[model samples]
Structures are given as C-alpha cells and as structure tokens.
Target: MSTKTGADAEMDAGGTETMTVREAIRSALREEMEDDEDVFVMGEDVGEFGGVFEVTAGLMDDFGEERIRDTPISEAGFVGAGVGAAATGSRPVVEVMFSDFLGVASEQIINQMAKMRYMFGGKTEMPVTVRTTEGGGMGAASQHSGTIHTWFAHFPGLKAVAPGTPAAAKGLLKSAIRSDDPVFFFEDKMIYEQEGEVPVGEDFTVPIGSAHVEREGEDVTVVATQRLVGESLSTAEALDGEVSVEVIDARSLYPLDTETIVESLEKTGRLVVADESPISYGVHAEIAARAVEEAFFSLDAPIERVGVPDTHVPFSPTLEEEVLPGEEDIQAAIRRIY
Candidate 1:
C-alpha cells in the first residue's frame, strides 16, 4: 500500500480550510468551464432548477444559459445531442437525473457514444461525461435507487468512475471531463452531503484505474465500492481485535484495480467483496471470480461476497434493510473467512 503524500495530498485554501465532496465536484466543473471555451453543462433541469439534486446548482447562473443549457425531459434525445456535440468538438457534461434512466438512452450511450471512436478508427474523440446519481440509502424506491454502475462497467469502450470521497469526487470528475472518451460518472446519492476535506484551488486529477486502500491490515481483504467502502471501514473497526481486515476502494469499476486487490489478497490470504448490487451476475461476482482465478494459490479459504439478495430493490424499509449488506453481514463474512 502506497500513500499519496506531498503534491498528491489534498490541500485546502490557504493550505488550511477543507471542502466537501460535493463542493469539490462543483469546483472541478466550475474551474474547467472557466478555463475552457468549449466546456459546457446541459441536461434536464440543469439550468434554472440547478439540477434535480442541485449537483449543478449555481452553475447555470455563473456560466449563463448558453453554456448551462436545460433541455426537456427526453433522456434519449438530450443524451444523443450530447454525444453528437461531443463528437463535433464540444466538451459537454450531460446529467442523467437518475441512473435508472440510462435504460431509456442505452442506444445513445452504448451504441453511439461508446462505439464512436472505434467505429471511426480513432479519427473522432467522444469527450462526453454522463454524470448521474446512483446507489440506494434514501427512501428513493426501486426505480430511482438501483446501483447501476455495473451496467456501464460492463461496456468495454466506456470509462466508469465512482468516487467515495469528496477529494476523489473532485479529482475524478476533472479527469473524466478532460478525457477524450465517454465516461460514466457514478455519484452515490447518499454521499452527496457527506462532508470531507477537498483541495480548494488549481487543477488536479485522480487518474482512473487506481484503487485506494482506505484501511490496511494483514488478516483479510475487504474490497468495496461506493457506499460499501463506509460499511467495510465500520466493519474493520468493529472487528479490530477479533480479526485484521484491509479495506480497498475500487473507485473506478471498468478500469478495476485488480492488481491491487490480488496483491492485498496475497498478504491477507482471504477476501470478501461487499457491493450494493445483487450477488448474482454483479460486481461482487466479478471480483470473486477474478480473485479466485488470479490469486487462488494465496487464499486460506474461499472468497465470499456480501450484497443485496438476488431480487429487485425493495420499496419497504424493513425488507430493504434485510436485503442490503450491512456491518453485521460484513462482520459475519470476515469471521467466516478468518
């Protein structure tokens, strides 16, 4: 495990004050738009309403309506327009109100934007960022609260990034905006207001495909993504004397930092994956399969996965609590493997 020190370390305004995750993202977009002439923000309710969740709040006033254009409630049409604009030389950050709405514009994303560069043999660059809120925790119900990052991660041509911290959120958002490829930026709906220290000024980018070790130990490795990172950290603290568990955040899903995971497994000799998605054919399944195939010789026991049961996200709070992976589930998995 490597620690990002010196310049890589997040410093605040005057090298003292810190910013939140949402604020960091806001700063990134603000700075990028200010510095670049072609950069603009567009989507439904992005302008006057400042977005459904206000992620793009205040940008409309700052950048003006021409840059922060608002469109109708047509996901397919606006998404397609963003793709076309990106291909034609504009840097457009398109917001999908909910990740579940991606299904409505799958053709524009998977078929058009993702395949554009390769189809044109690298002659064109689709520099489009599809920003959307994902994951569950609030009472958003099934249709609004699914962890659909895996759907985009499954695509080869699109870059998938999920930031767990305010700093990661800021850095990764800048990197996604600058990239010449289509990026699916997944922001956990619950973490929107979760405060953390973030850099205040200048340009910084957290390179995609890199994983962060949130907490280090020698007994077992808990590989988590998005909100699961918080759960894993809590589980690690609770099981402090009982077992040693290392928590890793795979911030970027498609460009998964599997090498880091395999290396950690080599030291710990055990592994567990905690995800919000269902256990079957999900991100946890992919991680489990990769660890077994690549690090089987180092394992002391079978790899385990803690995730929602194989079913749609429940609307009832009781059923939802029962289905979601929690600290108890993570502790049980750790104890079983240990």
Candidate 2:
C-alpha cells in the first residue's frame, strides 16, 4: 500500500500517474463512460459549467450532450430520474452539487434508489452512482459544509465511499460506477487539490468494502475517513519514533473494512476513530463499536473519536476552523489513546 503521508511522487514510467483527487475522479468518469455506453452523467451545470467543483470538466466535449447531459436545478427530480434510468437499464452517474443538498432529494435516494432492488426481491437492478462534494472548509457555510455521509453509511442498502487519496478516489469511483448496486461517492471538497499517485489502467479499480492500511506501525491505530485520513497520516508522521501509529483509511463507509481495523487493533492495542462528521452516533461511533465488539481483548485504552462535537458546521471561518477536526485533533486523540 502507498504510504499516506509523503512528498509529491512524480509519475513513474510504469502504470501509475500522479494526479489530484479531482483529476483522478474526472479520469475515472471519462474511462467508465468510454467503456460503457449505458453510463451517462447528469447534474446542474455539469456539462457546460463543469460542475460546481469542476470535476466533470471537459467531459461534454468528449462525450457530447447525450452522455454528459445537464439537468434542471431539482435534486429530487433528477435524482429520481437517475434512479428510474438505472432501474430500466442505464448505469447513470448522478452528481449532486453539494452533499448538504442531498436532504432535499432524500425521498428519492433513501426510499427509491436505495430500496428498489431489494424491494423487487431479486429481479431488479439499481446501478446508480451518486457523486457529491462533502466536508467543511471553503467556507461553504453550515448547509453546504456538513459531513453527512454517516446518514447514508448507516442507512440500509446504500454503499457509501469517501476517498482520502487520489488513487482511492479513482479506484473506488470506478468500482462504484461498475457496481450493480447503488453507491454514494462522497468527495471531500477540501482534498480536491491534494496530489497522489493513481494507477493508470481501465481495469484499475479499488473494490468496495476494502480499507487500506496507508501507514503501518505498532502503537495506536488511527482509522479515518476522507479529509481526516490525510490529517491522521500527517499526525502519525509528526509523531514518528515517539509513537508507533498505524494509519488506515476507511475508504468504504458502509461495507467498512472492520477486519483490517480489527487486525490493526490486535497488533497496536489502541484505536482512534476519526472522521469529519459529527461525533454523535456518526462514523466514529460505528468504528468504535466494531472495535469494541471484535477486538475487546486487544484494547489497552478507551477508543478516542475525533469529529465535530455534535454541532452543525459553522459559517464563520474562525468558528469553522475551531469546530472542524484536523491533524491536531488526530494528534490529540492518539496522545490520549497512547
């Protein structure tokens, strides 16, 4: 596995290329669209505007309006349309501008998209991929900055993935697009420009339900998702010889890699579950619960959780910085656990 914290590694002559998380995601979409005719993208201002985050930039010129279609500013309508399209036959990749806006489309996402296959017993398929930007920073304010991925991760029938590195972003997204199930791909807006080595191949895909041990050590195991993954990695590097920290990126939130985390805990005997979501019954809670359930004997300290203190993300920049969890938070958690 690639170490999470490192200098910007240039593209080797081999199969991997250095790319930002945004570029990697765009590449994944382009490759997937080229491979499958059924795959199409639709969202507000996605075609001409290149999406709110510009992750879909230059796709329309390659695939034309039919494949890279733009939709009305109605999350419920377009999201429901994507679900319908998926049910019929097409593999639709629908982008919701902000994950915070997903609440407006919750009916389509939770009830219809998530349950259609199961509701139909074993006959139907919901090959819909919902891509949305998440997390604080960029001062998107309370509504747009909330890390609400825990809702979908906890909800039944939806596969949730939040990529930490560029490689994870590309691979997990390809996997999500190719999967027959509905997958919620949460992209942390703050990490779009973060660079990493990404495998360059059409067949390159990171399987859903897998966790990568980004860094290996013997003391505390820090299992983090999305933005926190990098933060935790940096914290681990800072600690260095002082504390042996094992950093694991919880890439797939729903089908979480509990075994990987459990194995790390078995060796390290301490854990810190960190994510940008709220601390109250969020991703941290779930990871902590799993560790307690499976690795009780390995526990040397109470599991520490680093996340927002059960509050909505603040609009003010100072308050946002204060409320959002980061490398310092991970460091503090590791210290506590150690």
Candidate 3:
C-alpha cells in the first residue's frame, strides 16, 4: 500500500492500515454508527446477507437488526422511509442494492430528500447518506450496470461524491455521514476488491467537494472519476518517459474541484476527462466545460473526453468490453492530443 500524504497524514498519525474498498466502507459505517447513536444503516439484504456486494458484510452482527435494517424489496418505500427518518433527526445511511434501481426511488431522492431543507427554510436537518454501487465491469447488464451518478450531481440541493480509492471510500463516507446535507455516495462495484492504505483513525475524513491529485505530470492532464481514476493512473504510468500525464481523482461530483483542474490545465495546456457515464451531457462534459470557461486561454489542443457512447450496457461480455471505457480508451484519448 502507498504511504499517507496530504490531508490523510494530518488526520491519521497512527499510519499504515491497508484494506479493500469494501472493508474501508464497512469500517466507516461501523465507526460512524458507534460514534453517533442517531446514525444507522437500512437497505435490502444489508443485514444477514451483508449486502449484495458484501460491502455491508458483518455489519448486522455488530449493530444488530435495528441499526442494520433489512427492508423489503422495495426501493421507493425504503428510500422514502429513510427520508422521513432523516427529517425526524436521524442520520440514515440507505443503500439501494444497485444504483440502477435508484430510478425506482428517484421521486423520494430528487424531491423529498433533496428539497426538504430548502422547502423548510433551512430549519429542518436532512443529514442522510445514500450509498449505492455503480459501474459495469461486473457484467451486471444494462439495468444493473448503468452509471447514472450525473443525474444527482446535476440536481439542485444534493451533494454527490464518487470515490476512486479505499482511503477515499472510507474518508469520504465518514464526512458524508457527518454532513448536515443529504449526500449521495456512489461506489463502483468493480473496485470493491481493490486494496489501498486507508486511515485508521475514527476522525479521519476527506472533505467533501475536494479532488485528489493522484499523480503529477506536465504533458497532459487527465481528470477522472471512480474506476477511471485508477485506469488513468495506469495509463499515465505506461506512458512514463513518453508523456507526463497528470491524473486527478474527482471524488466529488457536484462540487467539481475546478480550481485544482484549472491549475493542472494551466500547466499542461491539454485535458482529457474520463468517466464511466455516457459522453453526451455526462460528467466529462461538465468537467470539460468548467475547464474551458475557467482556463480556455491555456489550451494548446481541444479537450478530449473518454466515456461510453450513448448506449445501454450490453449483456454479452464481448459487447460490454467493447463499450466500457478503460485504460486503452484513456491512452487513446491522450494520444489524439499529443
């Protein structure tokens, strides 16, 4: 595991505790539940089943059925319940088994959960965190494998974060739980097994709305989110002496760290935004737009975007592989500009 750096080192002096993304998320839940009695987790198969992805594995044994609630197979009902609970002064971490199912509960999330505080003139507290797994690497097919995080990121009065690493998974979740605003935490199902060094301290939290620079470079800047962050980093490494590629992990979706991205673009003068969402009106467009508006003068070449074309995730492994964005796609985007 890599050593601690930046804000991670400051919050965690104990140092060097490595874990998978799943473990980091579970640990964050355990710590948050223990720290605050009001905090609890509720979702389908989250109790005895330990979650479909097993991210909530063993949480039931520790927190019991009350805290680690198992809801009926109804996303809309449970999500609405979570909103009600949050409004009544409870910090509920609701998990929608798969992010694709989030559409079933879109009304509750986009309406009640998102608009409550504003509708109530900021008097009501909506400290709720919705955790859902996203991405298509598992071959979960069109319905289950869709990456629709951009919807919430664009929605008003909602905070969204998509973590790219284990530390980020843990730290960002902790911050999301504590946040007074409703935060949607998107976890890429493919990265659950990926391991990295995460902070051991309970107080550790990567601030929401912040981005982390995974690698520094000069030739080009590649801004990525979730799974693409690691893929872009690998692409950067492969180019080594050939291309100095700067990789930035955009952990927060809504509060896109344009400052960090613009700074990198000012130096590199070229950009490639890589995300799993569709290219049209997706995360890549938002990031690229921000760069153009903020750092248009620094551009040496047109910004490139790497993402899936406007299409559903194919059920066939071959077709899925063909459409999904990856290291090859990232490398190709970089090559076009260079």
Candidate 4:
C-alpha cells in the first residue's frame, strides 16, 4: 500500500532504500536465498555468467554454484526440472531469459506448473517462481519481446505478478517467492534501470491480490500494468489542471484486485485499462469486462482499453514504437472516455 502518484514518497521511508528495478529484484532473490535453505536459483548463465540481464550477477559468488545453478539453453528441460523440484519440496526460481522463450517450455508451464496442485487432488503444492523479461524496447526484435502474460492469467492454476516500480518489483517478487502456488513474475526489460525506493527488510511484501492507487484524483480512473503504470502516471501529471486522474497499478494480473478497480470506477465513473498485451481477447478485455459486470450503472462513460494492435512486436524501432501504447495513447483513451 505504499502507493502514491507524484514523485515516489521518500519522506518517513523508515527501512526503504533507493535502487533500480533490476537491483531490487536481485536483492529479493538474495534475501530469499539466504533465508530459505530450499530456495535456489536456476537458469541459463545464472551462475558464473550471472544471467543475461545480470539480475543474478553477484548471487553465484556469495551462494556458490550449487545454489545458483547454470542450466543448459533448453528452456523445457530446466523449466520442467523446476516444476518437479517445486512439487518435491524445493522452492525453485527459474529464469526463462526472455518471455518469448517461454513458448519453448509451454508444455511444462501450462500442463505441469499450472495444474500440478489441482491434478494431484490438492495434495501437492507447486511453489515454483518463473521469472521472465517482456516488452519491445532496446530493439530486441520479435523473438525477444512480447507481453504474453494474458495467456498465463487466463489459465486456471498459475498466479502472475508484474511490477512497474523498484519498490513494487521488490515487494511483489518476495511475495511470489513465498507463495505456495506457481507464480510467473514478468519484468519489463525496458524498465530495468528505472530507480525508486525499496523497503530494506526481507519481511516487506505487498499483498498478492491488492492494487495500489499510485495517484488519487476525482476525475477518471486509469488502471495500468507494468511499464504502462508509469506512463499513465506521467500522463496524469501532464494533464493536471484539466483532467484529475486516479492511477491504479494492477500489479497482479491473476487474482486481480477487482474490488479496488470497482471502487475506483464508482468514484470516477470512467475507466481506461492500459496493458502491454495485444488489444484483442487480452488483459484489457478482462478489466473492461469486470467494470461492466460489477459497476455498470456507476460509469458515466464507456470503458477504454489501451494496448498494442493484434500483431507481433515489430523489428523496426519506428514500427514497434508506433504499435506500443505510450503516454499519448493513454491520454487519448482517457479523452475518449471523458
């Protein structure tokens, strides 16, 4: 609940320290690695090589090669191993490098990691955490960039968390690590270097199913996820006098904080769902569906959805930027609803 709109509050931040999203995630992993003997990190280059994004840079040196295992390039092999390890009592945090590569291991994710607990008649717990990077910045092309979280969110058994700020990245990652069910933690590769205040203690964690109102206002409600959270906040700031926007960060996609959104819709009467996933049959559609279902009478305007068009992330920088929703896109969506 450390949610606020204007510049992240540094006042009275007792145990909070400033760090980048990447560093915050690494710190969470380190604390979990130290606190739990069963918690181990495994993935390509996570050991001596220190991960493609270097999120696991210094972990191998401190925890040794055994705990920070470097697996082969096979996503299915290591991912399936992590699923088996989680069911057998070990808490495995497996990195898939890029979320696009998750398709190579979809069978393990969709079939085993997601369904093990229910399929085993509630007798088993799949405490597996799959960490992957998403988004279209840095010119990574079609293969490396994608917002495929909606697929996992649509699945019944898996939990999904995507954080937009350093504090959120730390808090949500810790909670995901501790959860008994399988969790997919998606990190926007573009925001790795973005810095913010993060709680210093290992015990600090944001509740999994709660949403944070980053900016409180009386006009419209803009519910966004991942990178779009920050973008929508910026948009709100730019339109300060004309449009009073209330920004809500939908941190957890699955087990979404429907109550928070419904309440916001009641207050503002206008909602714009901003997700990086494609526009058709995606996260935006779900959020809109929720608003219509729960608070249809309170709405003063139609619900708007800001997202990429139905297509793969383009290789051209210009094309990618064009398709990806930006602050302008969010503002336009709000104006449409206004």
Candidate 5:
C-alpha cells in the first residue's frame, strides 16, 4: 500500500477529477496493468465491448488485445484458463460478468483455483482475481442479482472482498491483483455511479481482512457489507437522538475482521448484521455465530440479523423492496437491539 502523503500528493494535481465507482475500478485496473507487465485482464466482452457494464471501457486500444483479451461466453473455460495463468506466474483478473453466472464455473473456482495451493502442498500460487457484480436495484431479475459472497467465504483457501465505496473498491481491487491467492471481488450494480473521494495515481492498496468503521456510536453496532453499508449509515443518521448506532463495514467477508466487530460490541453490547442476501445460512449467520462465540459476555441482548427473506429475489420493484433489507428494516433492528 502507498503512503497517505503520496496518495494525497497524487490527488492534489486536480484536473477534472470526479469519477464513478465503475470508473474508479477501471482506473485501478489500468494503473496496475501499466505498472506490472505480468498483470492482464481477460473476460467476456472486455476487449471490444468494454465489458457488459462498460467497466473495462477503452482498455483494448491502450493495452492492446493481448493484455485485454476477449473470450466466448464460456465461464468454465475462461475461468479455468485464468486459474492456469495464475499458477504459471501470470496475474489474471477474470470478470465473471454477473455473480449469478458464477455457478457455471463453480468447479473451476472452488476446486481448482481455491485448492491449488493446498493441493500442491504450498508449492504453487494462484494469484487470480474474479470480479463480478451482484445485488438488486437495477431490475436485473433473479438470475443477474444475488448476494452469494457467503458461498465463496465458506470455501477454504479463497478470499472474499466487497467494497462499499469507490475509494475502497479501487484500493481493494489493487490489493486483489497483487495477492498470491484467489479472490472473489463482489461489486454492487446499483453503486456503479456512486462517487467517493478516491486518491488518484498508482500503487494504492487496501489490505484484506480489515473492516472500516463508517460511523461511531455507543448504543448498538450495525455490521454491513457492500452497498448495505451505505444503507446502514443512512439508518444510523435517521435514528439520531433515538438511538446511537455505530456502523461497521465488513469489507472483507472471508478473512473477517472479527476483532473490530468484537471490540465494537464490547462498547455497545448490542449487534445487528445488515446483509442484502437471504437470511438462512447467509453471511449474517456466520457473523452472528462469531459474535456469540467471542462477545457473548459483552452482549446485553440477543444478536439481530437484518437481511432479505428466505426466498428468491423478486423481479417486481415493490416485491423486491419488501423482500430485501432496507433502511427501515435496519432501523427496526437497531430499535430492538438497543
């Protein structure tokens, strides 16, 4: 990771600076590729069409087709190729297009890329980054929108990271590219245009297994991931004098920062996990389990989980909003906990 002073100096130039979350991600990839000859991006429509969401826009002209190669709609084939490339000393960033499409390449991800290091007795490294978008709000339907980070986190030897802001996205993506293990990077489709203060320039990396404290309070602790962090923050503000809610963004789900969460619970003695996934066997369950194991003595009441109903994500806007967790749901959970 680069020093804060250096990052600030790079951002001080100030020349038409605002960028969206998607644009910041594109910039991170561009900087990493320019710095390291071994780093290359390969995925569907990444070369000619600039990716499905325009996240990889105009990379083919800059780095040429070789580094920014496009491929058929074969998730299994290309994902396996990426895993092979990583083992052979090349850094490959594979975009799975949509999180729902990951099922087509699950074997390559779970068995091959994830188990390579252990299967080889730590003789080889798999430095592959699988980037994909998930969650609702774009009317992407059930197949295109789903928060399945918990599934990847359940697997060993792989890391899962979901950034809630543009700055975190850029830094974390850079870190993922340089990692020696496979990573599942989940991006929220709704936050594509969401903007934040990202320090410009190169060599900026946010380490994995760390959580960010978005808001400080004393009554209750709300742990959230991805765009849910934004919703948690809004709910915190709305509670105002009624409740002192602290928001903790669990940026990395796999190597979770349980220490931060436990410490926050020590002060607040109440917890609420706000996740945008199904309630049953989801990330919130893991978090609640950990809190119980580590912070049971500190907790004043039963831990609460704010998440979607245990049903498939609906396509209708009204039904989807009801099914998914929102600010009001979080607020209600906070009231219960506090």
Candidate 6:
C-alpha cells in the first residue's frame, strides 16, 4: 500500500507486479526452477502440503514431486541431504518448516554446509538456499516461533538475509538461489501475508549485502530488520511533522551494510537498531557495534536497541506480546535520544 515511493515506483514500471511475501517467495522458486533444471526444493510438507506456510504452494504441481520433494519429519536428514545435493552440483532450496528447529540440523548447517566450499579449497560449490520462517507474534510458542537468524549471521562462511517486504522477499530469494555460496534466507513468518510490489522478471534480483532505505529523514536513523522494518517505517510516517525518523530495511544481515548506516548516521547523528532477535549478542548488538566502531564521533546520543528480551517466547499471547518489540517500541527507542 506504500504508494509513489521507490518501493512502489519499482513496481509501477513494466514487468512488475504486486503480491504478498509468501506469493513472492513462491514466484521466485517457480522462476528459478524454470530457469534451471538443477534447482529443486526439498522440505517437509513442501510437495503435497505445499509447505507449512504455503510458500511452496502449487510448486509440486508445476515442477512435479521430483523437483518439489517432500521429506520425512526429520530436519537433520533433509537439511543434510540439501547440503549434499548442493555439493554434488545441484542447487537445492531447502525449507526448514520453522527456523527454531534449525538447531536440530546445526551440525550439517554449521559444520558441513557453511564450511564445505572453504574447507575444500574452492573445489566445492554451495549454491544452496535454505528458506526458513522466523519471528514471533503468531503465538507458535518457543518451540515454533523464534528469531534465530543471528546464529547464521554470526557464523562465518555463510551469508544471511531477512527481507521485510514482498519485493525483497522475491528478489532476495532469487539471489540466494543463484548464489554460488550457501545463503540462509530467513523469512519473518508474521510478514508472509504482508503485501508489497515485486519485480516481474526471472532475471531480477536484489543484490546481496545491501540495505534498503525505506524512508529518508534528517533526524534519528532507525536500522531495523524483519518485522521491525515495516513497523519502524509506519512509526516514522505517523510522526511526519512531530519527529523525523529515517527507516532502513536491513535486508542482508551478514553483510551488515555499515556504509549505509554510517552515511545515515553522518547526517542524523542518532541511531536505534530494531531487531526481532534478542537484545543481547544478536543482530542489533552487531549493528550497534559496527556503528560505534565506524560512526562513534558522529553519534549525538547513546544508540538504542529494541528487541525481545533474553528469554524464550512464552506460549501465552499476552506474555509473547509483552516481550516482542513493536511499533511502540521503535517509537519509544527513537524518542529516547531526542
């Protein structure tokens, strides 16, 4: 619904369309599969069930069971198979139903998939894209709902991205699939249904390691990820005349894009990092550390970090809501330094 802005303008041109995050992701999978016979999707419920989040909806019908494979309820097995497939010259797009379960396959992901190419002296190719849903707000509880992208982002030899909009979801997914490196594509589950404009071509892709400035302002700069990107943008829009808050969608977490944040800080001199990850030793902490190292002299006040407290997501909706940072949290964080 964001109209006339860069996000909207990108779609207004020919070969662009509007869709939901989930749809965009599915579309990206379709395009990649069509473009490459080596590209295939494997995950639980990905084939017949069309994915737990329906991100792979209709993919099986289009690509058949061979291309859209459904594995057992074993995360370690399927994820390991994906790593093997990618190493053997096939581009495997694996989906772990919930990112929280990624811990089950950490050995294969961290030790094998992430380390293969580097460990093999550049002999191996890891064009594997692991698509996993993250974030809380659906009350999926600690077992199902969790923001664990920081684990991959912090780990070396692996690239990580968390897109906040439909266009980003589509473009980034395609980029991850085409990448010759292992890319962890973390999609915020809460935003899957969120609508936005996306490019309509198979060749289009949002470059990895770049940040998208959703809104520009000369005041405080808010570097946000996942759900917080849209929330912070809405908060900024609501405070149009009262306070000018610049919002940046941190699409790529690993390649933190410190240049964009530093440039914005050079102008605004104030920063608040909004992440769905925990407040400690996570995405927000890394970004804040980069800001301090790069733009410490430009900072006008203490950098604020808005995120979930260091605790498991509670099963109770009220308790979950209490811990998850929201628009109010972003607004409050922005106001603290002003």
- Strongest candidate by TM-score: 3
Q: What is model 5's C-alpha RMSD?
A: 2.9
Model 6 lDDT per residue over 262-281, tens place: 98999999999999988889
Every candidate's lDDT: 0.85, 0.90, 0.91, 0.89, 0.87, 0.89
TM-score against native, each model = 0.94, 0.96, 0.97, 0.96, 0.94, 0.96
**Tens-digit lDDT track of model 2 for 114-155:** 888898995999999999998998887998898999999978
Best model number under lDDT: 3
Model 2 error, position 337 (Å):
1.9
lDDT of candidate 3 over 1-338, digit per residue (tens): 12344345754565758899999999999999999999999999999999998988898888898999999999999999999999998999999988899999989988899999999999998999999988997777999999999999998889999999998899999999999999999999999988988867787888888888889999999999889999999999999999999998989998777888988988999999999999999898999899989999999999999999999999999999999999999999999999
Q: Kindly list the per-residue Cα lDDT of model 5 for residues 125-234, writing each as its tens digit.
A: 99999999899877768998788888899999999999887777887899899999998999988889888777766755667887777789999999998888899999
lDDT of 1 by residue, 7-33 (tens): 146552234236666777788899999
State the local distance difference test value for candidate 3: 0.91
Worst 10 residues of 1 by lDDT: 5-14
lDDT of 2: 0.90
**lDDT head-to-head 3 vs 4, winner:** 3
Clashes of 2: 0
Clash counts per candidate, in order, are 1, 0, 0, 2, 0, 0
* Model 1 spans with C-alpha error above 4 angstroms: 1-17
lDDT of 2 at 176: 98
Please state the error at residue 29 of candidate 2 in Å: 0.3
The better candidate by lDDT, 2 or 5, is: 2
lDDT score for residue 81 of model 5: 98
* After superposition, candidate 6 runs with Cα above 4 Å error: 1-15
